[model samples]
Target chain A: MPIRNTDHAWGSINKAFHWILALLIIGMGFLGWYMTWLPNAPGKIKIYALHKSIGLTILALVLLRILWRQFDRRPSELPMPHWQAVAARGVHIALYGVMLLMPLSGWLFNSAGNFPLQWFGLFHVPSLTDGENPALKAIAGITHLILFWVLLVAFVLHAGGALKHHFIDRDSTLRRMLPWGTRAEKSSPPPAMTATHSTPNSSSPTEVKS
Target chain B: MKTVLLFVLASGFCASAGARDWSTDAAASKLGFSGTYQNEKFEGQFKKFDAVISFDAADLSKAKFDVTVDVASVNTANEERDGSLKDKEFFDFAKFPKAHFVTSAFRKAADGSIEADGTLTVRDKSKPVTLKVKFSEAGDKATLDADTKLNRLDFDVGSGDWKDTSIIGADVLVHAHLSLTAKAG
Candidate 1:
């Protein structure tokens, strides 16, 4: 009567954090890309501020996730091949590593730059390094750009894997993460007795034959 | 002895008359100077320049100066950006190749400094600017340091959204150090 290891899925809190953080990271990447080309647009400041705030939020959440994982036990592993399990673990680890690196790199980049970094205009964030050093600034700039590309590729790979399991594997790969459809009993459709036989005219007589 | 005295007086009159002319430099006087300028949140120095000043300090009352600045020779040390600055949007060196400051009024200040109020035309836009010149007498040389504030927008140097201080700052400070050699009038 107990669930097997193959049936194990992520808990509610883990599922929520994973999906929300994924969405935020993807959104931040797109905003960063678009910002480079919009030359002095009116909405540039608003969008840029939102980008900074979201990036900082992601950094905080990633740190918390690290701490949480340290104390909490994750779901039992799926009864897959050894190679598949190893590959899954490796990709998962890489994802978390990049998630932490991307934002921190961006923070350092803005700090080294001569331009001041603002967090939604409410407060001023001081530079991490002096902007006068052109060499340091260039190094930070180049690495920041490279990390962005890596983060983008990694995100696509993560999303693609999830979609593959949902459509091709036809498993509860995505269902386990769906907030409202997790309950076993509630997961199934209701009985189809009278509702299946009812015609369109039952609710509105306009559909009845004259 | 009376004839000798008349000759000395007449020679003194001729020398003073020659000094009154704008061409007089009062014994090969050299003007040496230095200053600072602000661009956006960045402030830099004008490293190298020579102003061939030919105005008499005493005859500054009736003196006029046509000062020329080498447009291609401005060095802010930011070569990439400064290179673009020499282009049409800013300096337009191809059309108006040189920037000029022509003077009409030169007043001696109470603090022994000289203030020259002139029209500096850059990129074809002329604005009245007063450069307060501070000088130190070193033998026959005049060490001159002048400072003045410049509005980039007034000369159409930078305008529109580029004027936003958050992006590229507006107020540009033009500081000058000039070395001039004076010639006899």
Candidate 2:
């Protein structure tokens, strides 16, 4: 429940950011698809506005999460193979990249369409263009969609890896990221540091950012 | 002799107040509207509209403006938005194809500009509006620029779910600029 993350577990702030962003992003996925099925009408406009507002909310949360990461401590990676560790890092980096790019592209798409942008009806967001830009609109629209798929795949791998660690490997990686999840005692880590899943030297437990 | 001279002078002054009829030079005129959508202001125009102007600078109180705008001809540069604009919750082009603005009274403003009080009818809803007008004349040619603001909700322009004005603003600004040529007397 600490404000700042410790060397072995996520802090309250990071956990909130993670879960809140997760729910919102998932909600956006549903909203994005649901709105497409709607007939073009005044109601559709309102739905699109709602989608934009939530997307903007996700964007802000992603930014705060990244900023907090810079000043927070990273729980050391659970003993795992060099290859699996490297793959995990790659997935995390990809997720972070899209975390920023996804909302930004959505914003560009809205702006290029010359649609008004507002954040939960609280304030206005400026447009990327002065008027409708067909070329930019097409490009941004495609990028926004592609990023959605990219994020889906990357998060799948990321979550799958965490589950693998928590279940098959019986490691504490997944728990550390959960809101109320706790880290295992460092003294008796599950027989994880063997010759199979990881190289011997890689288990030296150097602190790493996830 | 003095009374006869005074009467002749008064009659000449009254005759000068007679108005000249003018028609719009559509090529050089524009009838547009703007509104704040979620705090971002956007503008749109009526592509097909006409105005009949009758006026005399000597007596603006006698001036009149009659304008009719094709609601279906609205173009906001975004087709999707324009489509929404023509729906029943907005302009309802199917039911009311044209919107009208006609002046009933005119008065001079404190700033020396003229104010035209008119009734604007849109989507079968009518509301009294005042257009702050600036007019100028050169020879037989004249130009008129006027603008007014109204609450869109008052006319049921944003009905249904769009009735929530927190996202889209309620106030809409309508404007017109016209170049007119006097008819040959």
Candidate 3:
């Protein structure tokens, strides 16, 4: 596949960035929950450090992905009802917002709680806030938890939407975003396209954007 | 002229005769320590401590120093770490909240610094420790600066998982800077 997105399909670069970030976010969610109840020990401390390091990494990657999205062409919305289109756009925006906010709140909590962050024991990230304030720490902690729940719900909805598009809608909405998959057969395009396209579908392996 | 000379001699003799009691000015004094945790250095302090000192520079045999530190007052700025430090495996603040240090002998070192041979008691465990002290007096104000190093394991500071020095270091550096007011006896 090409590195740039076409109106019909997402490019390889965007697919890679999306899937890798998805995996990391899921892993971070598990780590965050597990580390909270861990007994006070050296192992627990190390795991906390690991969690912080990964959260920071996700933050940086998401920022770069946002910048990349701004410059790169995005696949136009697949055929759906006008309301569904608007809902999809809203979900995309919410996902991006949660991705950015979650890491930031975690960083703020660590700073207010006076927990020093070292990136994989390589370099220290200086705290954004000064001395420890219990009040700010508690607030940040609560904010972080709430954001995680938001992210979790949004994630489920996103995955469900993708599966619905594949199994029920029978559209290229899911397959186009896959890292590797069989090309959509040209002989039998879904019936939904016939209403919009005047020309008979070509026999080429690649689907032409309407 | 004769009376003035006799009074001067008597005053000079009196100055060297007795040890004066010195009370630490708590507002101006600090008792702090630092240790390595996971290869990163962290600083902490005891917010409440009292030092009782009596000394005369002219007489080393008469000098005495005693200090009491509230272990529960440990502030590392990180509440979680501070909470763990006060538990049974560490200072055990609930059972033994105060750490005491008392000097048995005072001697002048070759480098002109004073050395106090002392014993430090923490969590009911007492260990012999020596503090290299530097003393200076100006008018009615006196300053005492001392530092010493002690192995945390020696006093059973961390019991089970903490005994691994690779994670939290074994040696803890303790230092004190005391500003004292001397009361003439």
Candidate 4:
């Protein structure tokens, strides 16, 4: 219900951004795959335009989410082994990296292919490159495909980690991030200083302890 | 005043007589078009095309223009798009490999530019198109630059599902620049 993250759970805003972006990425994966095999028709072109628009949207949203994370508090790390904690950090970093690279490569491919990109046909995004270069286009295309696969693998691992915490580790790692999960009653209220005023510069001792 | 009027008429007739037959220098001429696809503009040219031009600047009625373009020679610099354009939904280059245009009349417009009225045939469909042309003469050589616009759908260029103009625009602008040398009589 809170707009900012707590030491115990994710806030409403962060959860919304996560779930919406997750759904968009999954839908885009299907659209990107299916549109390639579609016969040369108006419908195919329409589908391609939709795919590009959604891809651009994801790119913009990811950038905003990164900026938002800077100011908001992250939930305290769940109790785990040292190696697990390190692995979790690695996966998170990889996910963010792929999220940024995937759309960038796609944009470069479109620009080099001399294809015009429009976001829902409202306006045009200027091409990043001048003129057409088939070689650059091909390379960017291959890079995009490779990044998408990386994202897919990262996503699977991420989901597996969350589920592992929920069922095996018996922690709130999954539940605390869920939009509709019931908040468990706290035996002692969190310190007032750590409640709602956490800034990017404020790293509490609790985070250090975790 | 009467002598001056007679001199002016005589000079006009001499100029008409000097307007000779011209042949296109194929290597120096080009026929191309540009169209929008997915809101992006792309240029394409017919690698093989011929234009027959005969004109007398003093007499518009005696002018004639004819052109033939090999449809399969369309090169858009993109293989995938070129391939699709030649398919049944678009140019249908397999069944119709050539497009032709022949002018019926040439007139001098109010702005002093030449205009040719012709029927352009593509994919078995013919539609009347008028080209705004500018002609200039230099010694024994002449240059002709012309442009026109046509709706691809009118010529059945992209039929069936390809008729959706939202993806591929309906309007195609064609351009031609020709350098011609007067034939020795």
* Clashes by residue pair, model 2: A81-A198
Cα deviation of A42, candidate 3, in Å: 1.6
TM-score, model 4 to reference: 0.86
Docking class of 1: incorrect
Residues A57-134, candidate 4, lDDT per residue (tens digit)? 988988988889899877665555666766777777878888788888988998887777899999988898886788
Q: How many backbone clashes does candidate 3 have?
A: 0
TM-score winner between candidates 1 and 4: 4
TM-score of 2: 0.80
lDDT of each: 0.58, 0.81, 0.82, 0.80
True contacts kept of each: 0.00, 0.50, 0.72, 0.50
Kindly indicate the candidate among 1 and 3 with the higher lDDT: 3
What does candidate 3's lDDT look like per residue over A77-190, in tens digits?
556665665566667777889889888998999989887778898998888689688998999999999988888887887777788888998887677777774374232265
Query: Candidate 2 lDDT, tens digit per residue, A18-124?
Result: 88887888788889989989986556777898999998888888888888888887655567666787788788788889989989999998888888888877787
Worst 10 residues of 3 chain B by lDDT: B11-20
Q: For each model, chain A TM-score?
A: 0.75, 0.87, 0.87, 0.86
> Which of 2 and 3 is ahead in TM-score?
3
What are the clashing pairs of model 1? Answer: B24-B185, B25-B182, B25-B183, B31-B179, B31-B180, B33-B177, B34-B177, B38-B173, B40-B169
DockQ of each: 0.06, 0.41, 0.64, 0.48
Question: Stretches of candidate 2 above 4 Å error?
Answer: A1-14, A38-47, A71-73, A79-83, A181-190, A193-209, B1-18, B59-62, B104-113, B126-129, B183-185
The residue-by-residue lDDT of candidate 1 on A146-184, one tens digit each, is 878776676666666657655875444455555554552
Query: Per-residue lDDT tens digits of candidate 1, residues B1-185?
Result: 99999999998775555432222232333222212212224444433333445445656665555666667666444444456566666667688777778877889888877898999888889999988866544444555556777777788764454445554455665655544434443
